[model samples]
Target: MIAVSDNLPAGARQPTESGDCIDENDARQAANWVAETLERLSRSSFRSSFTLSPHDAEYARRKGRELIDRHAHEMLAQRVGAAQPAKDGRQTPWRGHPVFTAQHATACCCRGCIEKWHHIPRGRELSAQEINQLAGLIMAWIDRDLAAHPAVTGERDGWAAPPENPKDAGAEQGGATPQPRRRSDAAGHLERSRRHPDNHHADGASGFIQGELL
Candidate 1:
């Protein structure tokens, strides 16, 4: 987990009450490791044709770092009404702080890895069972890491719950009930969520009229 700091950039989003650049990096590493670590997960957990190249990994990492530097700390500042995250010249990551730390400290955040875990970005390209299997692999990876990591195991206050599996939308998480939105999401939103499009993963073109992603 990253320490909270006085480092910040101009025109950044406000920081949250609490911050964790360290945690963000951990999640990034974990996500990447998870993708590579458990290559034997069920076929449904991974697409036979899908694979991440070294170039792809590097590109994603760089983008993740850019995202963290540009928007993460500021968002943290606003969340807790706290001071913005100050720049520390530390290495950046794909996952940002505040929210990333707010999530599981051990859960992975490498977008490429998560893509393997859920295959949501490519969901439309595959079957439902494949997606569920992919999600399960991700779930299993996080559970295993949480059981193994010191920060996750020995702490009562630092550890938080992981996100509900989309496949288990109606399932319980850690003995707690889950709630889901009643309405189906917009196609454009789904596309944005999946990080579709060529230029970037940003929601969509800014100031442009929205259209159905599919």
Candidate 2:
């Protein structure tokens, strides 16, 4: 979406010459690349701020990894993966789903971010292998977040279960029900990043690194 200059950072890893198609060796290399990339991304306060809410974690768990993987493919193909997407930089939302959060956290939300962070080039449609690799990266982030905050079982503090039939239960017994914790949006951080260019690499302790998958 946003077409920032494609100037790679100093000491940045070079993009592979294998084009868009990734081979077995590429996959192995990609694993290491993803680890290093995520670490660098975690240094940015804006990028590390995105995390899945309990509801999102529950949804991912209920849907299973297979469905989540499918969603990754569908989302990548529809929202990204194209040479030039419909909205480009603004195509991805900041919240509403785990995958969306993962995209932001992992820098897979747009073409510019993808190229800047993952060494993936722009101006051409992403290959199936490339899409898959990106999807894998997204899933890896989601999995880590889910694992970091295990599902809260039983009744949470200050949360009360609602009656099956509120009307039948009568107004006397009805009481206020606590809402689920909402996932935080990084819009403020994004804006800060825009105003303060140096904010992109601001020093911050990221929880993701500790829970990163091997």
Candidate 3:
């Protein structure tokens, strides 16, 4: 299970605050890496133009969240100094998800970069809490990048479009639908109000007008 505290084993460095796992400085560095990587890739004639589709972006987010849930221990082992061998005893193959790509780009993928870029030096195993926080930072960076550059076809600039009338969402589900009042009803209400302001108050004609407009 992933721990959510900064508590660490003795001889390990105290973890940074969870909220500061991915700060403005980290985000800035990720952005620069993203820009430079793409620009460099563009120069390669053999490099195909590849951008993550909406499906790919969604997959990356889902996988990232799932990784944090199911693979925290393994991730920590690989990231920190567990010295665990791979299944084939060589090296674990990198998962080609965009979040992984972003993790590499953002220097959040391993302890070496985490130490160099994030200032989290490696001497002892990372606490589960730290691993979880690192996962969150990588996921956040992936989400931020995806939001900034959306897939061309599915959404507008990585944001889902708002419904025409957001307030009317409830109206679809057994809510009282407001019926438009006829012109005659409006005219009659006006006449009643004009004929007697005191009478209008007494008969609640003003109230009727308010209800009708709504």
The best candidate in terms of lDDT: 2
- Evaluated against the true structure, the overall lDDT of model 2 is 0.63
Tens-digit lDDT track of model 2 for 152-192: 54322212212233332331111222326553454564454
Off by over 4 Å in 1: 1-93, 96-124, 151-214
Q: Which candidate has the highest TM-score of all?
A: 2
lDDT of 3 by residue, 111-189 (tens): 5445544566655566655565555555555555566765343333334322234443343211224433323243353
Tens-digit lDDT track for model 1 on 104-143?
Answer: 1211222222343334342123233322233334344433
Which run of 10 residues does model 1 get worst, by summed lDDT? 82-91
The C-alpha local distance difference test score for the whole of candidate 1 amounts to 0.30
Error of 2 at 17 (Å): 22
Kindly report which residue stretches of model 2 are placed more than 4 angstroms away from their true locations once superposed. 1-27, 152-214
Q: Would you estimate the TM-scores of all the predictions?
A: 0.22, 0.62, 0.37
- Cα error of candidate 2 at position 42, Å: 1.1
lDDT of each: 0.30, 0.63, 0.42
Off by over 4 Å in 3: 1-55, 61-95, 151-214
Query: In candidate 1, how many Å is residue 104 off?
Result: 15
